[model samples]
Target: MKPWILGLTGGIGSGKTAVAQAFIDRGVHTVDADHAARWVVEPGRPALTKIVEHFGAEILQADGTLDRAALRQRIFAVPEERRWLEALLHPLIGQEIASVLAHAESPYAILVSPLLIESGQHRLTQRVLVVDAPEALQIERTMARDSANEEQVRAIVKAQADREERLRHAHDVLSNDRDLAWLDREVERLHTFYLSLRGGQA
Candidate 1:
């Protein structure tokens, strides 16, 4: 059977990571774009060169590592800077993800990409799975998880597509505003459905 590559995405603070973790618990191979993005731009990577050229050396910390906080501050203040950063990192991350997918032996793999739609990389996958919650829930969760202020969380969420936009891209949607037990049940059901789909039984 051809491997099913599912693009899993959502707005920031949408609990997509939790859903990805659930898939991992079920033994599904997961290639997380966040991890890939971080990996590809480590101090010596070519992508880091591009970033330094565009954003300058100030984005580098005293340890010569990428200062993610500084980068976030710059990009969030200037929309075009965010776009430039995305353009620089997305391709590199996508390339690495494709390499991983090529060697994946699982019946299916979940590609966790926060920018699945915005980055236009969702085309690499067979289906889009959206993990969603309300904007208010998103802000609340982000604030709680990152210990960030409401305005900061809202700013990040605002950078992503709204709930409707994300919903429109989804082949399947999991609403994650409920309790953990409910989310677990939803993940189990989705896993079963994915297995069936891979087996040509769905």
Candidate 2:
């Protein structure tokens, strides 16, 4: 049988990476969708070629790699362009995620994604785990971490699913309003819970 897959997700700056790292400490395998997304559009890949064809070479940096900041600004400003990019990248990212998960050796694995629910990637997992924080807090955290301004962070929060909507889809929710120590403890608790579920002890 295949290892159980946990779909882990959160809005920007919601501490999903910290939680995922905690799981990794307990020997759980993890796949990050963002990494897969980037991989699918590498310098010489088909996705990059198609993207350049559609968006023009202007989307690329001086080093011939994608200029993510420029693309991000373009997408958020124009919804259609975002949709076009997602249409091209999501399937390729999905395939890469599936390929990585298939080889997971842990009793269970994690698929970490910022757009897990919104993009329907949660369907690949047995359970949905949402790392949640208030919208205001999310904005603050994101701005601080990314050196982004309030307006840019707010725009990203606006584009993502709201807190209530994300909570509605979660089988498990990790609150990230506190410090890393608190977050680590919460992850440990969930790790134990998942292990019990995996072993049929719960």
What are the lDDT figures for the candidates, one per model? Answer: 0.87, 0.89
Candidate 2 off by > 4 Å: 73-78, 198-202
Model 2 pairs in collision: none
Q: How many backbone clashes does candidate 1 have?
A: 0
lDDT of 2: 0.89
The 10-residue segment of model 2 with minimum total lDDT is: 193-202
Please, what are the lDDT tens digits per residue for candidate 1 over residues 100-155?
A: 87777778888898988887878888889999988899888899999999998888
Residue 55 local lDDT, model 1: 80
Error of 1 at 199 (Å): 9.5
The TM-scores, one per candidate, come to 0.85, 0.87
Query: Candidate 1, clashing residue pairs?
Result: none
* Per-residue lDDT of 143 in model 1: 92
